[model samples]
Target: MGRKSSLTDDQWVEIERRHLVDGISINALAQEFGVNESSLRRRIKPNKAEPKKAAKSLQALAEMKVEVDAKAKHFAEQLGALPFAKQQIVSDLARKLTNTSEHMASAAEISAASSHRLSRMANQQLELVDEVDPMKTRAQLESFAALQKLANISGEMPGRLAALSRGQPPEAPPSQEEVDQELALLLGSGGG
Candidate 1:
């Protein structure tokens, strides 16, 4: 008797495919796989044809038909289709309502939380505004006033210099009367 072969079933299937599907010669396969030509031929024999379901016996066909009909009848009687369909619609509506309510609740929560956060942020900004040093503001206002006074003095200086260059005495300081009249006009009182 020939020694048992170490090749697997998959290997045998590949050898068969190469011989039958690829149309390789069996002698070549026999030589490559180191198997006797007769053994290789036996291993590559065509598979037996499976029995066709369409070739069922009359008894089996009758039994199957009875079972299918009985199942159909049972399903029709037990389903209570109209009520089951209505229940399905109600269940779907209930799920939709639950989802809508949950979504609304989440939106409301977000709105409320955002509003609270915004209010806190606004308050913090107001607090920061309040924290501004009053002395700094007063210093800036005083500096602005000083700059305005300096600008007025500088503007009159050129006219004074021109008068001095023409050998005329520099313009005399404003008289108290003239100063008083200008102050009255600026104070919205009719100039006296």
Candidate 2:
């Protein structure tokens, strides 16, 4: 036997919203309103008061907009989109909708695209925030590790020089030339 998957809160809400908005389908929305199918379907069938009421609600919904920019942007961040990619996507969408200029939906306060841009921006920002914090942690760890290495070198260095002065072969201090070579390599050939 297959296991039954329970609907999440969001799924239930969406189902109920659809049912309410579309005029409940008796067979499809039985669990949506916690009702019986046959009885509910009968009740839904071409009623005198119901159709008119439903029609009025539909008209209102048609005139309304849910304005999901905040949620969309938040979700976008949760999903991890790049900043430029987010802007490009929103810009393209805005241009498509506006059909005149490429910069039509450029900001969050302009039009319907503003909501979409905000979502994309928020998503991208979340990704950036997530990435940067980890990188900063890694950099701190690396810096601490480097300092530990330097401390170890400093500790051993005096003893090595003392041994050299006592007639053992001496290791030389790191020269400026070697340091310059290392810096050049680290900076890359282009100097960028």
Candidate 3:
């Protein structure tokens, strides 16, 4: 017969609960409960069927929630302390960014759905290539190319929107009149 366990039934239950349900490490539990690590492992029989729980306990989640709430409150207080004009600018910039993000998300969803549908259609076309007319395949390829361009535009839209929100226009080649004026100013200054 095996040696009698020094721990009570209630203590064993608590240890198993902490290890399996609470996701606490056996070593840590042993250290906390002042029991031998190997002995604790032998006593606790983990169920093979049920998946292990996440390491974070309910108490930990509660503490994290409190910390996040405090931080958000502090941030709001800081934002409220800002001058009205600065606050307005901040709010406008936030609104612009949010709109840009929504547009990008919508574009992404459309592109993804279109791409998936095209892929399925393409697979079917490949199987029917010998029987189907070549014109239909060409049209499908063109549609795919258009979708790719749309995806590229969607990827670049955020940066373009951000630049516009910051009051910077997209760079363009200088006009001939502007270049002439610059040249004249440089020449006039050099002659003096």
Candidate 4:
């Protein structure tokens, strides 16, 4: 003879309700009911109503899609009903704001770079001034004059000073050929 069920018919109905309507998993229900999982599954046989449930779910999804489409169309119609001049003004404002934002960002980057370069140059100049004695101001002025002359001749004084401040050798001056070309241009322009 087969083993008799420990649960009453009412308890079995409750278990089925939990497994289907409450969405309790079969394994969990089996553990709660103190029954073998296989026996619980066999007794429940949930597959019988799957096709009906699936059909209902698909119908609900289709209804929801129809609602969404209707709402979207209504929104589009409302947007289209706006005055053409108002829409044009809004579009133009949006474009101008976007362009202004880009320009501001570019200007900010340039300003930041220029500020950094100026700050570094100022700091270097301060360090140079600190190194010279105040009593030797006249000699210092003469040295500055010579440095300026060298800078003017090579067109690289600022670059060399920057490099020296960073403990680096100044970049090599332009080649003689390049210098000759520049000189030729100046002479040709009658302003040598």
Candidate 5:
């Protein structure tokens, strides 16, 4: 009585009867019939109810994930062609390969067991590369910034290595860090 619909009054009544028997939503019924959901709701829905919009959010998230995946794949493909970016060269003759093993680990058969072992080895390597070497007081493993300032001031790589080997911190050079450490030591040692 409120508005006209494509389906007749009898069809609307039957649709409502089916909806009751099936216990399905009017939107679902509309989707099943490939008709406008709003039109179907107006035609068949007897009880006024608010349709939830959660499905739209989930659909949007799915679309966002797809877009992210495509972008990542495209960037990875572009990066695959640039080989020089993957290696760090030291001493002009030796190069350290950085994570070329993603290809190996990505193999369809890199089992969880293998991954666990690989993770342990990787952690050990990271520690070795990042730890301050006790034998080499040159601060090679302390942090890259500290090492750079030491290299710039000392102008003697061999001496730096000797310093690191002696377990002495490479702090003789005038790094802002050294100044801060001096300040802290002075303040704490009651010399401030």
Candidate 6:
């Protein structure tokens, strides 16, 4: 290599998330993050083949769901024959599996809804041809606020899912003081 890159793994991940998920442009991300435009473009190149892959993945998921349902039914039938402790264990596992499946379905719905909303927002913005400052419109501002809220929920979802899988309550949000301290550290470190 000719030289070392200053960006960290987390920064690269954030860059990818902003570009891929938030639909931020490579040019804007490079200027905001002080990175090479070409490098950013290469790193976050869109996967045109993903729709096909996603279709296959969905098929696989459907097959897996059928298998899981069969197994769960078998287990439920056998649950009555097991000892009390084992029955309790099986019951708990079944409950957890059901919860996880529900969560997965909910997440998929949210993701689809978010994609639809984003597309609608993009179309609305494009239709504001006569407006000098489309972004300043009240509807646009409300849309941005709603998107920000969705982003925050999306960011916390993985942690919530993990907690649910572990049969634990989701962790509480950080206190304002804790958030301030973290912000100070980030600022001190130039946001890594």
Per-candidate TM-score against the hidden true structure: 0.24, 0.20, 0.39, 0.30, 0.22, 0.28
lDDT of each: 0.60, 0.51, 0.64, 0.65, 0.52, 0.67
Cα lDDT of candidate 1 equals 0.60
lDDT of 5 by residue, 4-120 (tens): 456667766666666655567878878776667778765554345633343345458869999999998987776665566452222123322334334433442334344445445
Instruction: List clashing residue pairs in candidate 2.
Output: 73-119, 76-123, 77-123
lDDT of 2: 0.51
User: 1 or 6: which has the higher lDDT?
Assistant: 6
Measured by lDDT, the strongest candidate is: 6
Which of candidates 4 and 6 is the stronger one according to lDDT?
6
lDDT of 3 by residue, 38-109 (tens): 888655643334323222354477689999999989978988999989989989999999998888767766
Model 6: lDDT equals 0.67
Kindly indicate the candidate among 1 and 4 with the higher TM-score. 4
Backbone clashes in model 3: 0
What are the per-residue Cα lDDT tens digits for candidate 6 across 1-192?
Answer: 645767898998898767655778879989999989888765555345562453356468878999999998987778878899998887799899999899886886676567566656655644543366544564654444445445444546656767778999998877756654654453343333
- For candidate 6, the 10 contiguous residues with the lowest summed lDDT are 183-192
lDDT of 2 by residue, 67-164 (tens): 46667778678547667787788768877877633353232124333334444544443344334354444444334333433443443444454565
Cα error of candidate 5 at position 177, Å: 25
| lDDT, candidate 4, at 165 | 68
Pairs with backbone N, CA or C atoms under 3 Å apart (clashes), candidate 6? none
Ranking by lDDT: 6, 4, 3, 1, 5, 2
Comparison by TM-score, 3 against 4, better one = 3
Candidate 4 residue-wise lDDT, 87-134, digit = tens: 777679879999987786566555555555555544444445424463
Cα miss at 137, model 1 (Å)? 12
Higher-TM-score candidate of 3 and 6: 3
Candidate 4 segments exceeding 4 Å error: 1-81, 131-192
For candidate 1, the 10 contiguous residues with the lowest summed lDDT are 46-55
By TM-score, the candidates rank as 3, 4, 6, 1, 5, 2
